[model samples]
Target chain A: MQVTKREFLVATAALALASGMRSAQAATAINYWHHFASQSEMAGLMKIIELFGKSHPGIGVTQESIPNSEYMAKVSSAVVAGGRPDTGMVVAERFADLTAMGALVDISERVKGWKGKANFPENRWTGMSQDGAIYAVPAYAFVDWMYYRKDYFEEAGLAGPPKTFDEFLIACRKLTNPAKGRYAFGMRGGAGAFKYVIDVMEAFGSPIVKDGQAAIDKAAAVEAITFYSNLFVKEKVVPPSAPNDSYRQIMEGFRTGQTAMVWHHTGSLIEISAALKAGEQFSTAPMPAGPKAHIARVAYAGNGIMKDDHVDAAWDWISFWGEKDAAIALLEATGYFPASTAALDDERIKSNPIYQAASQTLDFGRLPNRFVGAAGWSESVVNPSFQSVLTGQLTPEQAVDRMIEGLEAALR
Target chain B: MKSVLHRGPLAKLGDLSETRYWVYLLLFPSLILLLLVVAYPTLYGFVISVREMRLTRPGLNGWVGTKHYVAMLSDRVFWISLKNTAIWVTAAIALEVAMGFVAAVALNRNVPGTKLFGVLILLPYFLPNVVAGHMWALLLDPRLGVINDILVKVRILSSYKAWFADPATAMAATIVVEAWHGFPFFALLFLAGLKGIPEDLYKAAAVDGAGPIRQFRLITVPMLRTVITAAVILRVISLVNSPDLLLVLTGGGPGNATQVLSLYAFQTAYREFNFGYAGALAVVMFVILMVFATLYIRLTRVSKD
Candidate 1:
């Protein structure tokens, strides 16, 4: 057949268009919304994205980064406004709230059948499940621990990091010297103050919500509050700005040698290492135990399938977080403790003596209170109430009463 | 090369533009836009307020008439926020207007540095509330803050004080920062108003042997009454609606000492996931603003002009 130039050009163009459309149709698009904003966190996320792309050639994933403080607000608004991403990042404490708001899909069957699920411990699964249904897969953990100045301890002739609350207070009194413009502890009574308030309460054997009821041991909570606040108010071991010190203030205080100790998590190791030397200058230790119980939080942060339309792709994206390579990459970049047993064995993590505290905490750490309104009650009520005690505006008893009252209102 | 143009749909639209109802049709687009942007949202909020619409508690979502309002009656935070909002808006407005008036009058004198002064005066208005709040927080930091350093060095303070930590000082400190940021808005408006006042009136007053202060009181005051009223009303609305500055500085702490209505509602809605209660709080704010605007306009008698 004799073909004209016009006909041949038209035929080629049509063929190209048809092939492009077919390729586009075959590509499954999945979107993940998360709240990882730090440079290291973003780098880790990018590495995971690159890894995911290489493994799943048929799927295309897009990630949206929201600020951690505004993540829940954005997620809630998105759920109500109805443009939810295919998958979403969920932390242990937020799992209940996210599931309650219908932002997370039940993936019990998919999670149960996956062979790799065996790599995660029972506690890991427990954090991501509610009402006997799975919502997310564990990715990493923020094992609560303490960062202390080893040099300062040696100067004060202290033995080591305190093993009990009483020892901790004595160490603070001995280390604190106002003339040097240094305090013993950087008490975070500001934005994220809620975590420690709850921790102290738990350490004193006060169950925030017992058997799905608002059951707080008033005496224990008051004791916990009194002990925590006395570190600032009565003992003067914390800085004067303790009532207004959030993450930034406290971290700055610790890094600048204004405070000897700061309570954070394994996540801050990379940032802290940049400012101070490990072992020689600073070190990490397990949080000191209370009279009744030892308390630390092994908060497992993970990803959940928010929409079921692309369930297969969503499953791959979430489950990939548990893979050894992905977990190790995240650990290297952000210093996040891996949730998978396989990744925890990496030599890079095991070689660091500073990580010993986190390892110890893993054996005994409790999960944060997981309930529908846990986030709100902790933040708005508990934080301010505790700060009130720190600032001498309220007594420990008054603060405890306010917390119980606020929790009741929140649950209602 | 010349070609014959076909006037198709364009010609039809031109023809339609010349019709008798064209102006009304043109106005219809703007009316629709107003209904969409303004009316729809306000009405939607009103509807949401009367419903049990807690996002986290979706199972309990249903129509519940005034349940949120009834709860608000006993809400201690709500009452505290209401009282705080009144003090915040009133004190802030009074201070902002005074500063703006003084600045506008000084700049109107056409001094050597008036132009530069005007630009410098307007700088605060350019900063977003979030930035201003954070900047002030750092400046007022108890340990490393320059403000504290200066205060202590000059013996104005016994020692470095934690401004935001004390309930007595928290709101006052936030108000000072807010006033600094907002006075520029009034200055800009008042400066424009100052420009429009006829020089001839001042000259006539001078011929009658009136002093600068007298002419200002007699002529400039009455002439700029409308501008003052408008600026004050707009400012009151802006301050009432904005909770960003307070959010950054205090987050309505050290124990709700700096709590205002807008911040309270925001915490309730986003933090507590209690949209119904937040909506009720918002409705109260809306009602308060509406009544204030109405009474303010009547009292000022700006319509008489």
Candidate 2:
């Protein structure tokens, strides 16, 4: 039980060195949170993460999966509790609110030095920037289109998709058969009816909010709402249930041949492709033009790095994911479209017909205005007025007035 | 003789000598848990209700005092939600209680396959609330639903009807779904009460030439008062707080026709991020529930008297 002073000092030194190594190892571990629940998608994401980890041996990546329904709530709570992950994936629209809250680190300077920054389209880059400060990295873009049953379209004497909104209405009228339990369109006329309203308004060149004020009461906005409402109440081309159908139901309507065409996002392409593999015949077309030129509203999901003690780690991960090569890999693995124009030429990506066709429509992609208080715009203005118009509770004019009132109050 | 002379004051207080300390020790854990779980969150929620808290905000939100309360009071949506809650509570409770009593009575009799029937009656209650909402939604679907299919096939109607798409039908559909899910609770409670009632009371009634309905009105209703009152109170509280089924079934749609108070409060807080206003709305709802609970207790006592 007796030891020399020299031996004791040597052992103490060895223990301190081991503890220092352990702390250094722990420091390199970075946390990433995402809301992808699909098995295939998660596997693909983990593969990308593994590849990144392999390329950078100094940093370790940990993935946390959150359900889509509760993703926002969990992220919000995490930020407020000061336990936010280094990198988090969020919908593009939500980035504004988080940036406003100062929860996200402004990566403008870091992104400027990123090799792939110039390759991304201006629109995609603009989506991640607020007041010239880039707060997020653009990942993928989603655009809505009219998906129709090709066989039904032909049977109704339509040689091809309608090129104009009037022609679309005519085709709908011809395709509707109440006796056979089929409708011309499977419209979701409830709170979510705003999706369609947005499509039509954008097509008609009606600004959702113009000059920092809600311009829904404008003539163009009124016309768009009227056209949408007429499909349910006046034209009778849509079923009554359209008023309450969610995105899922609307898709189901198309799958089950309950409607001739459905307005939805390109995300449906995967489902449609799967259905086609199972012998269902369907095709998609760009939304028809209004009195003006056709305009497609694009919604996207992006990844944002939170401003925390781990800022360097956050930038590293963001650069890893947003790099053109990495973005291309993600696009091939998942059905998501790369936000970078350079990735559009990836042979593996271009080989997919859906991606090819979707790329052609990207030129028409438009995003909603960046209102100062945009978070409340959807629930307060879009949903309420959209519901009112669709349900015949208010005329298109009245709905516009109501939306203005609500939006003005919310903005104030 | 010396030992008897030395008995202490603590010993004289029988049972306190060996167990008093143990009683306090045993209760300590539960007391701490209650304070941590219930009291803490309640106080925290109240604190949050007075401030302009936003999840997206960076720092501590400034206090707005009674501003949130005033805004919530003046908000038309809040008032509309209150009216909807009133309608839902009244309709769901009344229908559930009546149907449950009838089902319980029918099960109490010597009917064929009584056990099977009882199990079947309890099935809907056991279903996950969200799944139940989806199931009913499918059944009520205007174009593809089975109920409309059967109704049309059987010559009951000429055309398909949107049961949940119209404002009038949407409210009715929500009430029906809520009632369907709720009745089993009342039925089970009433069945337990029925079993506990002595057979002698029925025998005495029969001897006195009391008719079945008259006996039910006099004996069964009077005897089952406590159980019935408890069931009603529980159901009312549940209906007031839980509006998820309606949210899923109708999405508070057809132009806010079925937007119940709970759903409004949820959207206000979570969706709108107006936590302060939402808290005020919640406080109002809590007060209403307390008032209702008090009235129910008083009414039950008066009926017994």
Candidate 3:
């Protein structure tokens, strides 16, 4: 029954350690929904999740993949049903809307302490912040680029990729040979053309939305639509098929050498490079500039944590993914550019020519407008109106007018 | 007392009451299920239609009675979608019926491989609508498609043209895809009706010195009237409600040139996140379909007699 003080202190310390370990192991699981459905990308995501789970042994992460087109609907339904995933992927522009709804947790303080904060580019962080509060973290940034067949450019006697809008048009015309069943360029023109049109408008120096009003009737936007339409209708540099093509169709056309060039994102370049290595020779260049200097519309896709219940766990999951090492690992595995500056400057990324070329454009990139209720601005108004103008169903002026009316109604 | 139990009116009343009670019990589960699954959502949709609901601004959404309805009435896209739906339904029904009747007659013959041909003709109906849309989109693709290549090689057309991209052709392309997928259903139903027709009637027509065309016009057409009516009504309802195929194939585009009401409502609800406005659009679409269905049923019944 006689006890030494040293032995008693050691026993107390051992008891405290045991309780601490037990509590750490009992942490709740956080649900993470993402739009990455590709096998390789999903595999990379799984690795990140595994790393997070290992580092924070108590925090279990449940990841789900929803198709990109249905992601918004699924997220909305989940939020309305009051069972939103603990963390999920969201577009940067819609962060404002989500924040306004109080559906997203502000991670400003948590992010400030994150070791990777200094590694993220100032612009990337700007996208994640609103009114001095950071709502989410940027995981990756994607921008539009002109993907072309290198062999086709050489065959057409072009020295290199077109440097400006006029040169791009000429290249398209020179490469087009209808008799040979080939087209110079391909553009998506249906309900999905808005992405391309938006890029073009940005390149033309048009603001997508200003003060909750439609600016499509502005001169820059009109010029952008006219320029795109001329490629299809006037010069006929693009095939008639451009109007109906989807992203896949356009990518296929460019990959199969059916078209010389297509307006697409950097993620597409990764896939196209693989196809190129398989005997299809292609390269990418920054999207051609309009009357304004070269400008690219950048979009981000990253994970978001719900504000309601799982705040701490969500923050842990986001911080784990946003770390410099984690981002670099993901970028290397998935062929996507990291949004973090340190990851972007990592020797492995800087040495890659495609990544370097893509990163140069990211410096000049800008996010789309963050109007609260303008989610459908691209699909409902921009695409249809652009289609109408390109197909001669409406004149450029009329198309612009229609788009304004539609945007006004949509924003209302 | 035994005679009363065996022959009196009380026993009949008891039997009738028992039969009624059992019938109600038997129907109860299905009735409850229908109310829960169908009726409840419909009622909820109406309630939602009166609210100003935005998916992104969930907390801000609140009751705004008749506002969504008024907005829909003034919405030009709504009008365009309604017009497109009308075109789709009329064209789909007319073409499917004609094609189905011809196909049913051709396959009704006792020729070699007739049964195999009949089954092959019905195969498209078995395919899911999304797959059928994608399949048609591929087949009709102007750039890398087999159809355009063949057409240009054979000098049928001067050059390749985008079938689904141009406004003039987009609606036609949608109509073709819809009709192709729908004709098989009509063919199967009409064939069943054709087989059920008494062969003796046709033989009597032949003996009356009537030629094949005359017999078809008189006996076959008149006899198949009921089946045709039913097929037309079903096709109309389907064509009006199911533009999901067009949504996939053309996405109601190349400029809203192919937008139907169902696709419009979906875009409004899911894409735009204007659930209240979309719910109002859905309500209007439902009413329109109901009116069309009622008229179709009456027309079919009158023709059948």
**lDDT of all predictions, in order shown?**
0.91, 0.77, 0.79
How well is each residue in B125-238 modelled by candidate 3, as lDDT tens digits?
999998999898888887667888899899997777789888898898788888888998888888888999899988998999999899889988878778877777777767
- Residue B67 accuracy (lDDT) in model 3: 89
- Candidate 1 residue spans exceeding 4 A from truth: A1-27, B1-23, B111-114
- Name the better of 1 and 3 by lDDT: 1
Which residue runs does candidate 2 get wrong by more than 4 Å?
A: A1-32, A37-69, A81-83, A277-280, A307-318, A323-334, A348-353, B1-32, B56-61, B109-117, B302-305
Off by over 4 Å in 3: A1-30, A50-62, A100-103, A130-132, A213-217, A277-280, A307-314, B1-22, B57-60, B110-115, B302-305
Docking class of 3: acceptable
lDDT of 3 by residue, A1-412 (tens): 9779999999999999999987666557678888888776887898888788788877888888997777777777776777788888777756766665566777788888887778776777776777898878888877767778888888889988887898888898899997776889877876558777776776788766777676653787778888888988888877677777888788788777788888877767556776775223777788777767676667776667875466787888887777776787677667777777767778877776665557767866667667766657778887888888877888877787776777776666
Error of 1 at B42 (Å): 1.1
Task: Locate the minimum summed-lDDT window of 10 residues in model 3 chain B.
Answer: B296-305
Best by DockQ: 1
Pairs that clash in candidate 2: A189-A242, A189-A243, A190-A243
lDDT of 2: 0.77
Tens digits of lDDT, candidate 1, A1-412: 9999999999999999999998786558899999999999999999999999999988888999998888999999988888989999999888888998989999999998998898898999999999899999999999999999999999999999999999999999998998888999999999999999889898998989977779899999999999999998889999988887899899989999989999999999999999999889999999999999999999999999988888998999999998999999999899999999989988988888888899999999999888889999998899888988887778999999999998887787
After TM-score superposition, the amount by which residue B298's alpha carbon in candidate 1 deviates from its true location, in angstroms, is: 1.1
Docking class of 1: medium
Q: Each model's DockQ?
A: 0.64, 0.39, 0.45
Question: Chain A in model 2: its TM-score?
Answer: 0.88
